[model samples]
Target: MKNDYLFKGEDICKSFGSTQALKNVTITISRGEIHGLIGENGSGKSTFSSICAGIQKADSGKLYLDGKEYIPSGTVDAMDKGVSMVVQEQGTVGKISASANIFFGKEAMFVKGGVLNVRKMNQEASRVLNDMGITHIDPQVMIDTLTFEDRKLIELARALYTSPKLWIVDETTTALTVNGRDILYSLMNRIKEEGGSVLFISHDIDEIMNMCDALTILRDGVMTATLEKSEFEEDKIKQLMIGREMSGHYYREDTEESIGEEVVLEAQNITGGVLKNVSVSLHRGEILGVGGLSDCGMHDLGRVMFGLTKPDIGKVQKGKGEKVKNAKWAVEHGIAYISKNRDREAMMTLCGIKDNICLPSLKQLAKGGFILKKSERNLSSKWAENMEVKANSVEQFCNTLSGGNKQKVVLAKWLAKGSDIMIMDCPTRGIDIGTKASIYQLIEQLKKEGKSILLISEELPELIGMSDRIVILKDGVLSGEFYRSEGLTEAKLIQKMI
Candidate 1:
């Protein structure tokens, strides 16, 4: 690759209502390079990228693109000037079709006077979909009809259509399956081959280490260090970003703990949309990990167990009680479900943190049909503190928090309810290292307290590390079962997953 400078940022600064988001961060990229950006949540990585991509303005910074002073008014202007970003959060409209979402903000291009040319828009969108090897998604189907993974793929297609000189991808792989990731890897390689640049962001250290030629570390909005591929160290990179030594116990090192004999929860011959005669048991004190590829029906198992979906044949029983028939019954019977889609399923985005946290336990917090506000606030505050939720107050809206903070709020809400059985699905999907460590510790602590947990995850290492017992699901059935032994490995679990 040529050593020509592709872009540069000088003294980038930004703030939000007296809170400095980025503190004079600066970095550069060269042609045909995939530069990795890493930082903890609230560390200003997203802020810096948003500024560079023109989604937000920098308070005091100068940027140069191709040796010219680059200034963009908005997202469209930024894309017009050859820069595009796939934001970390969801960026598609549910009510619109996939094709319409792909061509969003540029729909005017297909307008003839006042009339929109639907035929031309669909045709172009179809061509792009074909190019991306996305044959399962219909361009005319509403995005709401698609799954979260498919919708993320649609967003990727939207960015690809821009053909920008610089692509800013922020924590996108967490939403994709293995095949989708391979597609993205190929796309990034193709961009580098064509003399374009990519600024990739992710919480997966291994991904950043393998895919990026150079790495830029950010700590609380400050540029800590930048390292070449030859200089990369897993522990050192994390140390620089968090400004401390993270204990090497990345997972729970304890293997002596064994689960109790009593069965706390059981799925007995449960048959559902994706599950067929699925039977599993969660002991009194155990972290039962369920592992598989994204489409292997493992996630559906969690939903059915939580009563989000009723089985076509059998029942989900809890603690010597009647079968749990619905979500309300499940919650009332001390079962909690932390859904993978937090924004839509877990959090009431428009409500206060206290309201969301106390939502499940309101009946217990009531007196003579009158809701006790004081009790609500106290309970929410207690668990919020326990989870180390970073919010100004319990009155703060859950929607306004960062991704990691949001996940904490969800976990806290469930933990506050004192659920005996918890179904955690991808609990730390896109969060950073420090938060991940805390969550792992929390799971371990909960197990010690005899709170049974069903951890359904796409991450194999997490399954092998955190689980007391793991079951691999393939095509909605049990493929393999493993216990927490020194002999257990990710390769063994993966062998069953496929």
Candidate 2:
């Protein structure tokens, strides 16, 4: 039976400083099946996966691959051992061609006589990308020029280039659109058909149930339960993952539109990127959802509203028609942006939580041209506690925190700033159901407090469940608008999105 397993870990224990991230955890994956690994933030899912992928070493553990002791020195070594992982955050480097990103560390393969064959590398990159059903991205173009979803696909191409026996996808589908997700699902199914295995990690229980043959649930670094497909139950799985029972829907209970007539933020014929002459308005007390496919201009609209990116034509106006000039000006005038690209745009990974949460509110925390440490600490601590950010302390670096916690820190910073208008792009992406529920509740509370929110999301269900009014964009244009009602369904939104 041990020989039947493709990979196995026994008594895995890992710690960072005094924090026990993984505690005597054990798991197994057999050949030719996709296995699900799920847990709340900081529950040791990514920690355990990192150990297997050679990105991190376990403090104490024994790992067996194909019935042999497996110890990988690093990611390259793990690749050599038939293992590769697509990380949670952005893994591709900018200012480089897509082909270079795909063959990043393995450039030696394309070097002949100490000279790199760029064309061969590009050809192989293109082949791998097309093999994985990613056809639109150009291999020769700068990676930064592509959309976030395209870059994610390039990282997937990089992982599949080696044809590893075991592939690990870490919260990757959250970044993708429907088409990109379909491509990934096809690849996972194909791998299983080819007698290979996949370690699929996600915060979405429904996705895990539908995609995996079996799943292991973790809670605070402990393996609470392992359930087969036949034993899969949403409520049971949610309880196991969070160490508590969950009931009812996390979304808003109201079905009627409730909002003020005053426009807090309005985009006046904004045009840039994929957007073309798009205009929209967010009310004073409204969760105005912006939804579309990935390539639609919804994300650009969020950036424009926050003044992070200026529109080529037209302008975004605040209360009483004050034009948003730049991000600094927007922040100064009580506007906050929670970017969909959280790791890159919303956080400084090397900075501590205190710095991250106190950054946007520095002006408020300062007096007599000097900022007091106590003031900063008080502000950061209050918001961090409010957001329930999990860290050893506020001094812990952002990079060391889990995905959901990192997002919490981002939110904490903006909340501490006390902004009245927030442009949130995929705010709950890659977050667990428990945290998502809390965020939904928070959004509703913010609306009650008369804060306007521009909610941009690829999840149609989210828009229908949370928004006072929903706007659908297609090919960079406003295609449809619908008010909150029981008739609002994903099918109705999809009709506009496509």
Candidate 3:
């Protein structure tokens, strides 16, 4: 008889300031099993995993690895004890070479007499990439040059290189295309075949159901349920994760009419940086969704429209002749672009919620050329209430809040500005189903209110649900365009994206 347990987390408790990130959490993982951990944003899924991987220490918890007394000091210590994790955010250094990033913190193997062998490190990286069937990336290339999706792959490769007893993947598939997902899914299975365990965390319920042997549902820092594969049901799992019976198609179901006649925003033959001669128009009250593969240039299109990325070929214009020059100009003219990386680009994470919510409309909130503090707070409060943001107070930093709350703040900030056009890029990435549902409702409301929206996302269901019209891009070119109809399906959109 063999012992089934590989690791166990007992009575885990963690906090970040007043926020209880994890509360009395416990879980057991068997060797060779893929265990799924899920929750809404701020539900403490990441926190528990971080404790196990030694990235963050739990305030109170007993961790036993291989039935031993395991207390890892750091990431290296955790890996030494056979636990490795790929975080939700990019885990590689942008300025460093891919080879250096892959071997980061474990470069002692290349050190000989106080000198590092650069050649040997690159050779090893190349070998690993070849073995993994990744040929587009060069080991010598800097990480900054790679796209967001490719950088994620590098991180995945980095973790896989260790061949640890346990692997943790957190919200990675949300950022990937189909090809990227296949690669990751295959790797998790490979680990299982070698009698290793995997801890997979994702907001994609379908993925968790299909890939996991057991599921652990977390809600408000508490373990809600832990069920075996045999007991798995989509409705049951969703109910456990959200603590509610959610009804309705998470996407818009109405055989809806488009909002207005005026073309509010237009991109004429936009050509630059993965976008080649693409043209599109956003009508007032239209929810236009752009879809594509990971590298199909849709990300660039979002940035270009927002004036963050200058177009090499054409111009993005609002109204008749107002040329969008830069981000500042875009904001001044009532255009709000919510980036996919909310923490990185959209939110001022360290600042107070009031500041973030009042930022875009500070000029409007001013009295006689000076922004009144009372007006700012009021504006923030009004929008926060409208968006139903859950926060102790407007004084809390955006970074300290959950993913859903952070997104609400972002929306509140823009809504306060009364922007006519809102460009939402991956608006609900990594958030819980409940949060996703709220966002979809908000998008629908925005369209009905006669605001033009360019909804860009990697998730197919989101495109299918929210978009009045879906534009598909393939390898930096316009591949296909489909309008909202009874016959439109994810398969049709995917056929064009590939």
Candidate 4:
């Protein structure tokens, strides 16, 4: 058993100001196995993984790698000690080439005579990306030019370049598409086959069951259980992680709710990005779901509908024939967009919660052409409390919150604007099951209030469960459409997606 173990964290503990993230948690990962770490948001999974990966330090505890005391000064030091991590949020820096990002910390290898060998770095990066089964990306292209999923693949490529003995993937799959996920799964399997260990964290239980040989559950910063493959059970694991037996269905039970006949939003002959002559409409008081393969243009459709991206030769119009001009226009006209790229596009992370929530409603909260702090506090406080954002106060920094909390802040900002037409693109991505339920209930309530929602998601189950009508996009075209029915299934939806 000693020889089988590759890594161990003994009595690990971590804290942030007054909050205890990890409380004397202990875990171990054996060689050549994918070990899962799962919990609700703020359950200290990322904190522990980051500590092991040397992005941060545990306040008190011990870490052993290969039966040796391991202490890394930083991420680069960790990589040198045979550990690498792909973080939960975007890790790749923008404004640089993908090649530059892949060899970020190891630039000394490509530098000689006070000059960096750009060509050599590109060649090596190209090789690493191809080896990881990511061939579509150009190594020389700017990283920001790529989509969110492609950037995640780049992060995977960066991790693969290290060829570490242990890899820590922190909730990374939430940003990937189906093809990207397949590539990631292949990489994890390859690592195990080559006698390497992987620490995989995700909110998705089914994924953990399918991919991990063993899993450790956490709740409120304490280790709940460490179960082997034979002991893996969905209900049991969920109960342990959340500390409660999940009683009702995750999604809304009502499937036969009627939607208003009025068409609130429409995309007419839209053709841009990955979309080609696509047309769709959102009815008043309806949840219109868009689903497809990870590059099928459904995400782009959401952006276009929200006026973030202008179509090449088409128009997005409100029910009253008002052309959706741009983001400002969309917001002013009671249309709100919750972007899939939450960290970058949705809320301002560096800013406080009050500012983020009150941003879109600035004009509404201002008096005499001056925005008062009290008005900001009042409006932000109301929505923050309504959204149940767990933070010290409305003035708390957005960056300090957990993934689920950050998502709630994003939703709070939009809801504070009092927008009736909501375009939520992967709104619940990377969130825990508990938060997902809350958001689902919120969506249903919004629908009841005559709000139209254009829900764009990669998860078929989510689309089938929440949408009044589901549309599938395949290779930049609308392949099939289905009205919500008892017979609707993921298999039926997948057939059209592929």
TM-score of 1: 0.95
lDDT of 2 by residue, 365-403 (tens): 889999999998888888899999988889899999998
Best by lDDT: 4
lDDT of 4: 0.91
Q: What CA root-mean-square deviation does each model show from the true structure?
A: 2.0, 1.5, 2.1, 1.6
TM-score for each prediction?
Answer: 0.95, 0.97, 0.95, 0.96
Model 4, span 1-498: residue lDDT tens? 335799999999998888899999999999999999999998999899989999899999999999899999999899999999997678998899999998888889999999999999999999998888788999999999998788888888888787899999999998876788899999999999999999999999999999999999999899999999999999899899889999547886876746798999999999998899999989999999999887899889998998999999899999969999998899999999999889889989999999999999999988899999988999999999999998889989998888999999999998999999999999999999989999999999999999999999988889888998999999999999998865689889989976
Steric collisions counted per model: 0, 0, 0, 0
Order of candidate numbers by TM-score, starting with the best: 2, 4, 1, 3
TM-score of candidate 4 relative to the true fold: 0.96
Model 4 shows how many backbone clashes? 0
Backbone clashes in candidate 3 total 0
In order, candidate lDDTs are 0.88, 0.91, 0.88, 0.91
Give one digit per residue, the lDDT tens place, for model 3 in 1-498: 125888899999998877788899999999999999999888998889989999888899899889896899999899888999997666788788999998998899999999999999999999988877788999999999997778888998889898989999988887676888899999999999999999999988889999999999999899999999999888888888888987647888876546577888889899998899999888888999999887898989999999999988999999887889899999999999999988889999999999999998878877898989999888888988898887778888887787788999998899999998999999998888898898888888888788889999888878878888889999999999888874578889889976
Worst 10 residues of 2 by lDDT: 1-10
